[model samples]
Target: MPASRDQADRTQRVQLPDETGPVPVSIVHAEPRWFGVPPPLLLFGLAASLFVLALVLLAVGSWPSGLILLGLSALLTAAFLETARRRPGSERMRAAHSWTSSRLELAREHAKRLAEVQGLRGRRAVIESERRS
Candidate 1:
């Protein structure tokens, strides 16, 4: 049988606070790959251009134009990716948002709660007393 909802929620999940330092105040900078997504229009346009080129080459009975188009397409793709990678100050903006957001705040709160539990372990009375305080 499948697991219950509470067990499913608690188990098989990495506690985010545990991954970082004590107090969990450390910045978890998002990975670059997390922000990277291929532009849909770009993919669509490339497919359409390739299809058109293939049709044109077939009609003209020419291998050279097709080969040249392939080479140019490869070159252009490389250039486009390189340009996108630069991204005009995007690195700085990402760095700023990563630490300033609620994500970091929630991580800190989780860390604080985990620390309280760890500090009060092996003594239920102590846990109750600490809670009162």
Candidate 2:
């Protein structure tokens, strides 16, 4: 077969069956699964509760201890919020890394298959030339 015909055959699209009927999906990728509420919300809640407890301490007679608790709560809140902000980006990075690695693996497999085909073609061409000579 000619190269153009082979190329067209490889480029042909296939339809897949789904609940919505036949869909022409090319590249299949899925979003990462979420099991529960994000950690940041929980961390912020904890910080808020701590701040309330510190206020209660201040209302009572422990000024030194209340100040300490308030400072700690502030620190925890800041850390948790920062972590929350970076969490999505980091998760996305990991997902992107996984996607990139999979693509590389697919490319490698395709290259190997193409090399095998080219090797067979070269052998066939050599035989044809020998026959003609």
lDDT of 1 by residue, 22-120 (tens): 553667876455255454335335644874785688678897887677666555444434434444236643443343334547978999999899777
- lDDT against the true structure, per candidate, is 0.58, 0.71
Poorly placed runs, candidate 2 (over 4 Å) = 1-38, 88-133
The 10-residue segment with the lowest total lDDT in model 1: 92-101
After the best TM-score superposition of candidate 2, give how far the Cα of residue 125 lies from its true spot, in angstroms: 99
Clashes of each: 0, 0
Pairs that collide, model 2: none
For residues 1-133, what per-residue lDDT tens digits would candidate 2 score against the true structure? 5566555557657886566867577897775544553465555667778889999999997989899988988776665555554564466544544554466589789999999999999999999999999
Q: In candidate 1, list every pair of residues with a backbone clash.
A: none
How displaced is residue 20 in candidate 2, in Å?
22
What's the lDDT for candidate 1?
0.58
**Lowest summed-lDDT stretch of 10 residues in model 2?**
92-101
